[model samples]
Target: MAAYHARSNSFPSRQHPLIPEFDEQLCRLRSSEAASSSSASLSGKLSGLQDLHDCVDKLLLLPLNQQALSNQKNEKWVDELLDGSLRLLDMCNTAKDALQQTKESTQELQSIIRRRRGGESSLSSELKKFLNSRKAVKKALHKAMESKCAFSLLNRDQEVVSMLREVQSITLSVFESMFFFISGPKSSSWSLVSKLMNSKTVSCEKVNESNEFASADAALNLLISHKMKNSDSTVEENAQKQLQELEMCIQDLEEGVESLYRRLIKIRVSLLNNLNH
Candidate 1:
């Protein structure tokens, strides 16, 4: 919420016992985000963020850290941290909304497939509906991405504030990455199928295989454009498989984000309570 400035070298109290563990968790998360573009890895990043925030909350509970943060002279940084928390909450809630939308659409299509509701024409119609729902999700994700969260630099002596600001910065980065993952790469002239297949040199095997949503999209597109037969059991099976994978991924991400959201709430309450005291 404060004017964003580059504070690249900032670190928490050097002697704080929890700082090492916190740093390790943060580094692991950054490494995980950089090492892969898979939904599985993003789920891992969410877990690592939870651990990192737990450390932050623990630090907040320390007598010396509380004393520092609660000082009236530190009011500027306190306001910044509080505002940062709200931004994080907004980002988390947006991600949850997108994920929920995706989950519902996926379930609807899956149900139709399981019921063997109709012939190929009917299935194609439902698949088109599903794809259209995905476009809405992507639009929401794109707009959410535009709301940037920036962390501000604090005085060198404000160790606790510096540490929290760093946490906010990294958390913002991870959320942006998650939004991109959920949105499943922007559509272009290349087409989702081509992007999944030949867009990235290091892409995982199969079409957009690393991204559950993209893979599902590719599968559905094939069904629609190819006009596959209703009697083709493999066609239905593959579509079902992709949808199942997406459902599993959605559940994992939903749980992770919900847990992380709770952690953020707890941290915010702790900060408020400490300020009051």
Candidate 2:
């Protein structure tokens, strides 16, 4: 759970878009009662979405987590999860691209206004500041993109739409499985998991075929280890092995985020430099 926490400062990441929105609302809320009420309502709605995202993250990791308990029984299901996660990773980039495009559109709109103003009026200075802010935002986004390694499977932003559809297909399949497996009449024991599964926020439609960040081979090895022994020590050893691989992937994801954050920090620096000048 703690592993999934995002950085405090940066653009809204795909993983926790609400957090940034919440923060922005908080800043506005500081100035007005109306803003406070609006933000509070928004926060309420965001919480549900946050719950869904977090649950999806955990479900994505269930195969590895279950290995820790010596109960790896689902090779086929685990493989499916792996495939979904791979597609998810590829799709996550799409989410980021969408965000960038949205920001770019906003900047372009501001640029048009800035051009029309042409620095003739009192508000021209403010318009110039807005333009500078937009430039800085673009720079930060570009720097982040430059610093992070591209997704190995897919690199083009033009593919984001199709890739997103693919991800949604996988998500729906996962939700369908969870709906039946955890929420089925016979599976009352998994009620909590069932509830999360039922969350309206997470679902994907059918894609031809797709997949996750997890390797099928590693998952298979873990399954073998669990079947070979029920002893605590054996499970512990295998769990540790799975942990090592999971951590590396987690770190890679973190690095991608860290780049965006670091670039944002530089944007602040650049902003200050411009103000001083």
Candidate 3:
């Protein structure tokens, strides 16, 4: 797919920029925290997202109700916008896959750092190289956002436009959640991330705050990031805590997906009512 680099200003009420960012998390621990269960939860959420995407795609493929149409039928907008929405959703899924890969990579990096005290340089170099290789994914993501944004302008006067807009918003929100756990592959981005994940001496608390963290959530993130930073705690203990956090995030995602599912259903029901009228 051509990398569709669409800026947010290309549409109105833009919530986030198309700038690329990568985020990922790694962990293991708590007696109550099951890596299996956390993994399952994440898997379930991704599946639910896939189901949602499929639902929209199927809806798009349905024949347009020409019988109920007026002379000014622009029903193709429905199909085209749904196509764009699906493209964006696919991009989000690819991002989810990338996040999953990062988790595995983090595990490998952690293990290597443990066995080879002097291997950090080589490992860091490899990680940065890996990130550069993923520039295509970054471009695809930005392009997907642009596609969704374009849907907003298409068929603006149509009733279905409102529903497509809602779907676009929900899809973007899901992407944001998935991206939270990932960090950039850039040297500086990975430098802090690796240290937080692997170095026992460095404290997330002591790290200088960046200007990007001006929101109230930034304070909470600092606390959570502090927890993620390595400490004197046993590896098992730390893993348990991290998994617990992961589980919480997954549960939140499940709720969001469920909510989205309900909303989508409502939109479908409303459309049916309109058609029958």
Question: Which candidate comes out best when scored by TM-score?
Answer: 1
Q: Pick the candidate with the highest lDDT.
A: 1
Error of 2 at 61 (Å): 9.4
lDDT of each residue in 84-187, candidate 2, tens digit only: 44444333353245334434433443344345454334333433443344345445444433443322232222121122223334333322222221112322
Pairwise TM-score winner, candidates 1 and 2: 1
Give the runs in model 3 whose Cα sits over 4 Å from its true position: 1-74, 115-149, 154-157, 173-201, 207-277
Q: After superposition, how far is residue 1 of candidate 1 from its true place, in Å?
A: 20
Q: What is the C-alpha lDDT profile of model 3 across 65-142, one tens digit per residue?
A: 222221135455545544554555465455655544434443453454346455535644543443443444445545
Clash pairs for candidate 1? none
Reference-based lDDT, residue 186, model 3:
28
> Over all chains combined, what TM-score does candidate 1 have?
0.86
Q: Compared to the true structure, candidate 2 yields what TM-score?
A: 0.25
- N/CA/C clash count, model 2: 14
Tens-digit per-residue lDDT, 134-216, candidate 1: 88988988888786655767776676788788788888888998898888676521275555334333222454444888878
